[model samples]
Target: MRQRNKPWADDFLRENTHLVIPSPSEHRGKWQELFGNNNPIHVEVGTGKGQFIVGMARQYPDINFIGIELSKSVIVTAAEKVQDSDQKNILLIQENAENLNEIFMENEVSTIYLNFSDPWPKKRHAKRRLTFHTFLKRYETALSPKGELIFKTDNRGLFEYSLVSFSEYGMLLNEVSLDLHKDHDPENIMTEYEEKFSAKGQPIYRCKAVFRGE
Candidate 1:
């Protein structure tokens, strides 16, 4: 889906540098210092519209949440939500997921969330998928030794591909759900896309996996 250009996005980002975070790479491994706490850090790779991150931060006050989004137009909406939430535990970064290692050091992140990411369905674009092996390697490096990766999506093909990718990468699958909303998990924080799809009776697939250490 093409993003609609928001004319005021630049000004909004400039005014809310505190929430959107400028020069994120400079902070690198010192994220704990930036958050002013030693609490575990959880990241949402494509935090669309900030719903999931904000909801997660509200539910887990002790855990720090960082949202990475590449679009200036899309992230502006997320930054607005974060500012309105007034939650100290949530931060946003307008950065590409491919550069995850550049912004975080090994063992710096405790958990990574991939929620409703673009499937990049074309065979030629398979590498662009967030669950592709290359991205998995980046996540593995940045995550702690026992760090967990939670993924949710409405795309069956992408979910299957991710399962195969995770298996090939030697990651252990902790949990897999083909119909996430069937159980109506109270702890589950729904993203904007999740709500839209699930409301239309679409099945949501979710999985939690951890890297296998040598």
Candidate 2:
């Protein structure tokens, strides 16, 4: 569901400009320099409300994290969460995932996370699915040679589709979990949607895919 426009959203983003990278294109290959360290960087696309990324940032201080959300209202909520904490490794960017190639250089990112992404259930909209080869190709270009893509979703159809898509794209898949919470992973950090849906007994699906050559 699309969030209602919050009138203060834009202002909140502007005020927290320090927490966001306004021109990501300019920082393409120099992202490590932006953080003033050469830590491995992980990006989360469609990071709604920021729970997953924020939690990861807190858990892993050795890695630099970036959360990209297309909606200003949505990203503002993530920024607010960061502001209330002492997490400095997290950076929020208001950008579309389609333009990821222009935002990061090849082999610059170590991991990309897609949590509860829009399933795009319609047959005609398959290309728009984050797990589609179109977006996966872009992810391949943006990721490091050894980078991995971690995806989680509650939609069974999308999960099944992604498994086939990953195989067709020559990706090595592992950690395939059809029912994530049933196994109870101590390291699993739930996203906002994951938390709510899992509470209602929605079986969450998760997997990790890496390029075969990489």
Candidate 3:
């Protein structure tokens, strides 16, 4: 059933023009060509089906948005959704978050979104959690000194563990909400996964954490 939805998803993306990315890999600095002018970049990891990043690009025309997802099939769906939106300021990339540091230059990204990352609930697999200290360090390296990380999840344990992890790393907690959908936070965005999970009567936990001054 889920696989059946892929075509429709791709079709929707094709119809939406706003979710298109001209070229995503032109920013390596090794290439003689610079892709876009110095626009503040915002990234969303695990952008399931493109609802969140594409919506943000449509809402904020000034800033640029990049949606990175590990699954090729999923990213293709996301790309299609973005294509339907016709947003020139957005880009879609098929890549894992762990290699993010290589794809982006230091201080290149202004903001990042970690939406419902895998919890890796098993004790033995704790290191694989997206919010783990190692991953956070990579994010710190990629982010600008003032860059912010907007993390949202339906898992309470992951949220709690992430809170401690951020604190231990000396990252500043700029904002947090136990129930994101109900909190009325102006900056909060509702993603495809977020809408589905919340529809199931789940509380959405979210927070903004940032690395301290350089």
Candidate 4:
């Protein structure tokens, strides 16, 4: 992660922060207070440029949204977008998704969004992929009972691999679309990456996997 112009980026990250927790670990038990109500909290694992979560927050005011990005530079961009809008229900946190459980308690998150996550295509880096078992375990740990896991990607191999991984873990899938734009799902929202890659004639795969284990 690159160091951002703290003075320039400070205003963005501090915007709409009626209540801000300095540490991710502090959020482990108080997600409800952060949103000013007991609204269901949904998360986007890799919010690029913040379009998806920002749009979702506008569309669904009753639901709280938090975006986690590993790169501070990209998060600074997302923070800028949040500063541009009036979204009291949306927040961006800079952190790697691998340590997801550190910030959220078991069964705390109502939903999980994985948008165009890193493919890490090389054979040696398969475990680094967001869909890998290692990452999924952390997601499962943070997710609420029967919580939703919505994943979208333009890479076919990752989508296919995710499908098998979900099945292997005995997760239930509700909306499984190999091509999102073609499927016409009402609840579906297009992220920045989805829009970009699709404009170039690429197929966008999407699915919602729910945890059923107790």
Best by lDDT: 1
- Poorest 10 consecutive residues by lDDT, candidate 1: 9-18
> Any idea how many clashes model 2 has?
1
Clashing pairs in 1: none
Model 1 bad stretches (over 4 Å): none
TM-scores for all candidates: the values are 0.99, 0.98, 0.86, 0.90
Q: Which of the two, 2 or 4, has more TM-score?
A: 2
Give the whole-model CA lDDT for all candidates, comma-separated: 0.96, 0.91, 0.79, 0.82
lDDT of candidate 1 over 20-110, digit per residue (tens): 9989999999999999999999999999899999999999999999999999989999998999999999999999999999999999999
TM-score of structure candidate 2: 0.98
Clashing pairs in 4: none
**What is the alpha-carbon lDDT for the whole of candidate 3?**
0.79
The order of the candidates by lDDT, greatest first, is 1, 2, 4, 3
Mind giving the per-residue lDDT tens digits that candidate 2 earns over 107-186?
88999999999999999999999999999999999888889999999999999999999999999997899999998899
Which digits, one per residue and each the tens of the lDDT, describe model 3 over residues 1-214? 1433354554544554334332345554321123255678888988878888877887888887888887656877778677678777777766778888877887788899999988989989989998899999988988889999989999999999999999999999988899887887776668877888899989999989999965
In candidate 2, what residue range of length 10 has the lowest lDDT sum? 12-21
Best by TM-score: 1
